[model samples]
Target chain A: MKHRVAIISVGNTEYTSLRRETRSKAELAFAAIKEALDEVRISIEDIDACVFTSVDGFEGNVRPARVLESFGQAHNVPLIDVNTGGSAGGSGVKEAVHLISAGIYELVLVYGSPTFNEVVDNQQVLNTASPPIFEKPFGLGAAHMGSLYGARYMREYNLTARELAQVAAKNHKAAVSNPFAHIRAGYTTEEVLNSPMVAWPLHLYEICPVSSGAVAMLFASEEKAKELCDTPVWVEAMSSIADTFLSGYKVYKDFENLKILAQRIYKEVGIKKPREELDVVEIFNPFAPFELLAYEALGFCEEGQGVNLMKEGATEIDGDIPCNPSGGVLCTNSGISASVTRHAEVALQLMGKAEGRQVKSPERGLAHSWGGNDGQFHTVAILSR
Target chain B: MASTEFMNKEYNMHLDFSVSLGPAYTKWMKALGEKKILANKCSKCGRHFVPAKPFCEICFEPIDEWIETDGEGIVESFTIGYAKFRNLPDPPYVIGVIRVGPSAVSMVHWIAGFPYDKPEDIPDKIQIGMKVKPVWAEERKGDLLDIRYFEPA
Candidate 1:
């Protein structure tokens, strides 16, 4: 029998561009970690273990998490650093679940702090993740990969920049009410398309900004969760899949791993008609076109109709199934931390704590994230109240 | 960070890091230095791979055969880069997703040194499935850049 896991509480730092956040990386992470413990009225000594998630490359400090031993309260304890590109946060929580489920630890805290500063050239940071032999030599940034996918999807699905723009505009508009969102200008289609073009088929507004932030989530066994919190969101099911590290090796470009992941997660969670069954969704879409791709891949709609869902406003805050109720990654992207925020967002919604963007008494929710080379890695978790 | 809150430090590393090219890449890059194409083939599934990986992703089995190939491929898709990711110096350039030989996938690389006979014909010439060959750089250092770019075959 699988051990039941519950999310007791979550804490996050304000999502803003890296340049705007000058505090030390530890300070930023400590702020969120401290808040999570306070939410559960617990002290650092209470946690049994820690799962640290973040990219050391971004911090310019190698193995910074090790340096954060005492600050993370995992000193002298096994602090497994779950590093999976942009989805580290989600991966960490999954690790926490396994730790508790395997009877290794009763309580675990998943802490992630990914920081980018002006010191490193913002443009070069993302490409460093690419395998040097294949992708890095081309010097293509993350957005270019998005462009390749967006361009092909556009050609195959008859997608338009306007359709992609709608996603950006919608997410930004929604972020207007989200205090944590980094870019919340509420741009229109024209304004987004008019925004400086990054790569052909991708404009500035269509891509995510470099937001600096941290996220901390506390997880415990079902028994401990019930005692600690009135409403502990249960982890129903979780799955992660990876495509080839080299984008060139992956033949299909339909976000194939994500689609495979969705089928498995839906089956495991006993979800049918995900659009109707899941109360709310928190998906990662660093690029706007991906939102539509994810919608189709996740079975929110048919293979090519994700754009139609957007055009019809089927994913709006008040839609039948709201998506990215906390403005999604497009609005408050902190790269690595953004992924876990999805799970946290859904947990908040299920616990009736999502103050600004709560769905109507949501009972079940799905949180999703993808990262690495060419959407190479994906994590999906189903949560229930 | 506030405008007032900051520290600037310039640090240079005297040491260089190295990665094992593995058996597959060690042979592949060695061949690149020789202006030859070496690819890995899965003995189990008969699938071929360029920029050879250690194993067949499909079969998850170790590749046992290595094959030499004609340095030719076709453009599967193309995009023009007009901006940078962070601060990486990416100027305007055309990137083509090239499907080399009958290999299972395409490699993301530059489509430069275009052998276009006319300037106005560039777009019409660089269409999908257009046959192209490697434009070997004069000097070879057993690296990917050894073959500067792909050009019309």
Candidate 2:
């Protein structure tokens, strides 16, 4: 017998524009956790376990589990801090669901926060992801690696610079209504085309902005969920996959990791033809092009027809499949916190709590995260009402 | 095999010997010394390359043949750096992605002959379609540094 788990409530600290805010990353996490419990009509004592996620290097610190010990002290709960570059949030959710189903914990609190706005050299933090022995010695950073992929993608796909511009334009338009988005205004295709290119085939506007924020989710066993909340978003299925860190596998053409994971989740949830089954999608596309490419990679569309899906307004909020209605990474990037943010938004949508960004009658949603150099690691979750 | 090992000849130091940069990249620096940029001509795919590497990303086969690029290209994109890194030029220098020919990918190199005296003197330029050519150093070495920068064509 498997124990069913549901997200009862979601909360987050308001995104800070000014870099000089007094709150630390721990404070942000604590505040968001507090708010989440308050909304769910539960206390810290109710949480049977807690999972915190953060990229310690980005905070210019390490062993954040000790700092998060305070959350455990209040409730006397077992706590674990998961750090997996940019996908820890999704990993934490996966772990929380398993813990609940395995009869270990009844309620789990998942929280993630990053103080990117206060970092001295964000590039130095990002550079550490490269292997120290071989690649890091050459000073190959994430931006350079991403550029390499973008250039290769352009050549292989014969995608024009203007088509890439469309991604930026669409994401920016979606950000207009998101109050927490780092960039709020929509940009015209001409504006995006004219913007300075940060890396070849990737313009400044197409890239995600560094943001400081935290997000928290409250998960409860199905029995506790019914007693605590009126609307509980069900976790239909969740899975994570990882590839060699420095192996430089053929991720572009051989995206079987993501495809296989999607197929598995779809099988678990009894869905076919994901484009029609999934009403809302929140993919961790830090780069705009990946979102379009993922449409094909995930079997949402036929090969080489991803651009057509976007041009037809199929991915818009009111279209066939709404994507990134929360403005996504293109609007606000808090590093490892992105995974949790993706899950939280899906939970909100399923609970009919998403304001200004909700997709109507979203019975099923897909939330995905991909990180690690060369797009090697991934986590996928299927959420439903 | 034992008899052959016992009859070993005298070992002598060789002044000129090929160095393996990594896997494939055998003849590129030699071409650079002659002010030439070479890439492998995949007999299978017909794709040209530069800073030549070992195998084709597409066909995944050894690329033994080499072809010289026409050495004419345009700036696809560029960035004006405000910070320094290893082997990169100083602050306010332009690094651009230049399209060499039919290849989809562009080579990144620095821009030369730009007025860098004052912030205002910085060209209100750097368009995507700007034509540019590689500028080799006066004394060439068969290395990536052979082309000091890409100057306006």
Candidate 3:
């Protein structure tokens, strides 16, 4: 017997690489935490415990999770931190789900603060995941490694740069209406194709930028959800499965872990075909080629045919199955919390609070994220209203 | 509320140490320094693993045996970059994954001597299954840079 849980509120600060120098990191976090608590008409005192999701060394703090006391009113609370690489936000939400599912806490605050500064080199920060001896000597950094995957995927599936640009152009166009998006500009296919090549088959526009932001979500049990909000966005399922540590050790050309995770969640939620059953999808795609890999992995389309969805405009805002109506990670990714925002985006859509980028009354939605090296870690959650 | 809008302090924490190469990588690193490419053989599955792992992910067997290669491989995938990155060779270079010898697994490395005039023409120059050979550096340091890059055999 699974205990049902619902997200009462979801909020996040402005997503941007250039944050105000005057503001402190904790102040930025409080803005998001306060916004989420206010949506549910609950004070910080009402929340039982907190699950803080963040990276270990990135925040310039010894233990990044212990800084939750700075979240305005989160003090003396049973706080647990979860760091599953970039999927920390989704993992934190999952921990809260377990707490409610285990008949423990009724109200849990899920918070994440992913920060980076002007001094940090974005490529070097991510390249830390590479194995020191073999990979480092070759200069196979994060961006270079992603391009490697894109190159293989292109050669194996006969994918072209033009097709990949269409994915980027679509997301960038959608971000134009999203106030939270970091990079919001409608790029044409030719523009993206002609853009400087970061790696072969991938251009500068295809990669995600290093933005800074914080996110907070209020999770409550079914009884608590009924008392607080009229329309509760239920958490259907969350699946986190990781692969081998090295991308060099990956067996599959595409996202095999995501496929395995999607199958498990789909079986649990009784989803026959994800494309038809789900009304909306929010995928955490750091690169353009990843979006296509996700489409095939999540059963949105068959392998090598995700390009057809782009060509036919089937994933548009009003298409059969809308994908990333709030833009996506391609436009605004603040590192750690990027994956967590995937869930918040879906929850907002289901709660009819998606503001400008809301889809046409989507009842069911899916959120996905990939973290760590070589697309090794994948977390998926199915949400419904 | 306690606030700090005026104070801006910066600090750099620099720590350096050596990590044990363990049973597998220790052997592989030493072999690379000696101008040899090595792959760990999974005792149970009998498969070769490049960039050696302690055990097989699929079979869960400790890598007991090793295999040596003549530094020949085929291009599994290739990507050419035009921008210059820190501590790397000049611009307009090819980097790719190559399946060394008869191993099922591939290693990521630099692919030099790729037939490409402009960055735009790189997509058509290198294809999967292209033969390549390693080009070692003059001063070998028993690291990844021992073999400078892999070129058309």
Candidate 4:
């Protein structure tokens, strides 16, 4: 890295269901950008560059960055669009880090657009993400893509439905305190089990809602970060992994790609024991069972032992190595924004600015984002105060 | 606190795309019309692809060799759709990750041909690693759907 980069500020809007959203695309972008800039006490002119992350088809507009003027376009700032399916947010943030760390830009802004806002029927739109000829006609949607992992994982480990619900219940319980979270109903294990089954081995509550919201983050060089804020979360290490596009190419038994990614990142950061070394963590889990799958993939526990972590209340707010203190994407998924929130939430926790969902004085945290076709891409970052 | 009335606009995207099957997939799909399942084997890796890849992703070599299988696949994993959604089949459709004919990878398709007293019993009728055979469509069009679905064999 040419220069050290740190996260200075994060801006988030109140999340709601897609139909209930009142803010237009511009409004959503403006509100989040304004809040991020206001927190750092800097205007859009101060930022050197901007990065926008969202899927083209999901937004209905192929080039959403061109349509949305709130990303420093008025000030003539260069904007870079990043689209890696759901992992676009993480990739955008990584681009910002590169801009600063390369000594090319001092301040960079990454915006996580509400990707699902323009969809009439989310399932119809999501079905388009499948391979057009081969997989699309089979009626495989996002939930079905997520259910493949759960169905295979459960059979592999003899994991029961009640155990999966318990893992989901943890996130639902944590979301009650997160003001930015969309589904704050705080469903319990019984409630999750009782919810209507959308896909076998996955209840309706276990899946993420099609949320409407936006999030933005400010990344600055070490010198700029020192001048801008009292507390800044330093980017220790960041990297992402890619897999084959066809979902069938992957073995659904576990997050093998994520496991390989975590190993590479952990080795780079010299993290011997991820569960003991990291104080707080965030995982991209649109499906409830994914959190448990992620737990094993992230090396929080040994293989087939993620269930024990859930049973022991290990990932709760007060538990050792608390995960998804902001309720996670399992509760509120605004597509790309949800992936960006994983990093933003960790930064907030490290800065002691997490408000209702703060983990106690955390020094080191990990943020992960999973997206693309059946987990084609995964981004992992290690952040510290 | 503001009024709940939010003005909304709607736009529909009606777009069609024509994808080229290329040489590898062309041969594979053409075989399906004759009720034959062909898998392309990578020389370097010796791993077969069910859908017949143009090149092996791992070896990065062109898959020139082809082998025909009996279309018998093992259910690697599966999910039963229990709820209705737009552009998808009705409830109780089983989608399985079927590893056909010694292929290193699995392909997703519908799993059918089992007796179920009720729609809810669909999940119980299927199991991972269960052997299945292809059920060809009455009219073949050299498409992936040429095989209607896989059924318990």
Which of the numbered candidates is closest to the native, going by highest TM-score?
4
lDDT per residue, candidate 2, A1-385, as tens digits? 2888898999877665435345655667778888899997778887898888776655655666676543656657888778676788888888889999787888998886663544544555566666553234334444555554454455566678899789778888988877656678788788888876555556777777777778889888998899998989989889888765542223343355788788887888888889888999988877777777677767788766777889999998898888888888877787666779899888888888887787888988898887776566788999888
In candidate 1, position A325 carries an lDDT of: 76
- iRMSD for each candidate structure, in the order shown: 3.1, 14.3, 2.9, 0.9
Provide the lowest-lDDT 10-residue window in model 3 chain A.
A66-75
Classified by CAPRI criteria, candidate 2 counts as incorrect
Scored by lDDT, the top model is 4
**lDDT: the better of candidates 3 and 4:** 4
Cα RMSDs, all models: 3.1, 13.0, 2.6, 1.0
State the lDDT of candidate 4 residue by residue for A113-208, as single tens digits: 999988877877888888888788999899999999999999999999999999889999999999999999999999999999999989999999
Deviating ranges (above 4 Å) for candidate 3: A19-22, A71-74, A117-119, B1-9, B84-90, B113-124
**Candidate 3 vs candidate 4: which has greater TM-score?**
4
Kindly report which residue pairs in candidate 2 clash with one another: B39-B49
Cα lDDT tens digits, model 1, A1-385, are 1899999999887877765666667677788888999998988888898888876676666577877644444446667888888877778888998888887788899886654542355557677777776778686777777777776777677777788788889888888877777887887888998998777678888888878887888999988998899989999988799877876765434778888899998888778789999889999988888888889889999888988898787898888889887878887777677888888889988998887777889998989988777777899998999
What is the TM-score of model 4 when looking only at chain B? 0.96
TM-score ranking of the models: 4, 3, 1, 2
Model 1 lDDT per residue over B29-78, tens place: 88999998777789989988787778887788999798888979877666
lDDT tens readout by residue for model 3, B1-153: 856545657776576968777878778878888889987788888888776678887897777888898879888776676666655546677777788876777877888765656667876777778899988888886777888898888
- CAPRI-style grade of the A/B interface in model 4: high
